[model samples]
Target: MGVDAARGLSVIGMTMVHVGPNSAEGLGGAIYGFPHGRASVLFVLVAGIGAALLSRTDERRWDARLRLFWIAALFLLIGLGLQSLDHGVAVILQHYTAFYLLALLLIPASPSLLFGLGIATALVGPIAYFVLRRLLSDVVERETVGWGDGLGDVLAGLVLTGPYPVLVWGAIVIWGMWIGRQKLTYASVQWILIASGIVVAISAEAISWLALGQYGRPDDSTDWRNLLIADGHSQMPLWLISSIGSATALVGIGLAIGRRWPSAIWPLAALGQVALTYYIAHLVALHFLEDRLRFSDVRHAAPSAMMLAVLGIGFAIAWRRYLRRGPVEWIMARPFDRHRRREASQNPRP
Candidate 1:
């Protein structure tokens, strides 16, 4: 159920990011926010949640993890190809693919260890970013190459620009895993999450104000790379606060709803059941509508509304038709199942 809600939220976030503000208009833009960067953050955090949940399931075998890694890699390749063809070189999927691989490796660790590592990574991530920025800034200045040079440069650029968010995101994943291992109905856990979320959100906002007052507007184009570093007091803090706050709020809301009306879980569950499929489907649909059809303007309204309606109705229908898996879910599961069969054949005693 929680997974379902997370999936639905991810779709919402994706829609906002792809649709952009100009197209969305007043209410739509307000609901999503300008730049809509936070939506992707939410999607990544929920991804952590889903990964944690999967780690707890019986399907958490080596072959299963490898297959998932390959899937992420495939997406990463697609993202890279798309960037090379359409946009320049600022694609995100390569980083996502790297993060996915890292998550797969870390997912099997004990929750306590994972949580401790998450905390350590969060604390160190910014500092690492700062140091890397100094080094990379030199390279960029010396070479006089714009950030979007070659694919290699872009990949390197991501090491400094990209790793920080993934570090924080990895922590969120660990936190989700810890939550997954817990007794779900505990009131104290809920209170703690809510309180922590509020405090973090407030702190982030306050810091952002301070930074803006001292350094200038958050979007000031002094050096685009500085935004990724901690010294700038812009992107890092804002991202941390917003992502953590939104993720916690989501968990709190899900728990509250789960307790209040159990049957309300259906739609979210249906969405979650086919999360990977829907995620890929969204990319494909967005590409088709905006790129192939050349109806980028229509994307402002039609795509989002159509996606929402389709997902809602499709989820309802899917729930009735299939008891456990979504269409994509069933497809992805096959490779893992085959691997399991091979393992079973080798070790028949178990």
Candidate 2:
């Protein structure tokens, strides 16, 4: 329930980042900026935690691995298909598949090892990306949104240069896997995570501010000095660290809140449970409304986002009353489980 609530918040935050009012003045700026990079980080981290939970539940290793493979394949196909729509937003499902594949290799690893690898990725991925970007400047010139262009371009994009490069973003997922393995229901653990996350987030931001202030931001976007700043979507080490910390803290807070007052967060938890459906639905809505919304205008931003949330949350709650899983989730689950589906159908949810 805590995880679902946290994931719900992540979805909502991401929606705000996409449609909220963008003003550099007053509370609107802070509201618009708060979830910029952090929402995606939380989203990815939650995915890892979910994978870990799945692995823990299944008794047969082969069965779990097969399910993960199916999921990855589905994501890859769907992501590629979505890219063809030219929806404007950089779809992350392809990169998400990369993380799912990576998880297969690390699922059997010890929690400590997982944590170590996550930390190493946090430290090294950005630097490696920087070096690779410099070296392969000509080959990977564009953002490389989809594989329709070429295999090399898409591979480079998914691994290093895309909006959510698996190399750097994988750390959050790995750490999330570690978090899932922990005894998260424990109050002590929750508090520790909250405190440590706040400390780490603050320290990372402070260091980034000091470094950037002292050296000054360079005109060149590719300058190494740019890496020192912790701006959202910059994909720098500091940003990664800060995002991880903030995400951890948010998850911890969600866990605490859910434990304390489960009923209070029912809507959020319901929304989280069907997050994939909401994500896809929102994207489709955005695509249709793209011209009319005029995303650049502040007037439609907040209203659009509010409408999305209301519709999404309402749909999730209504759907959950009749079905155990989301529509997409149900399709993903039963496509490979004919026997399970038969038994479930016979028994019925109620």
TM-score of 1: 0.73
Candidate 1: residue 45 lDDT (0-100): 62
Best prediction by lDDT: 2
Task: Score residue 46 of candidate 1 by CA lDDT.
Answer: 63
- Over the stretch 1-350, how does candidate 2's per-residue lDDT look in tens digits? 88898899898878877665434455766776688889889999888888887787547556667778888888877777777664576777777888888887777878899889989999998788777767776653437466575777667777777888888888888999998888889998888888989999999999999998999985665688968988887778999999999999988988888889989888999999999889887777777777654365445676777788889999999999999889888878886578667868899987
Candidate 1's C-alpha runs over 4 A off are: 22-28, 57-68, 81-93, 138-158, 161-169, 185-187, 218-235, 291-316, 341-350
Tens digits of per-residue lDDT for model 1, 259-299: 67757865665665566566655556555555432233443
Clashes of each: 1, 0
Each prediction's Cα lDDT score? 0.56, 0.82
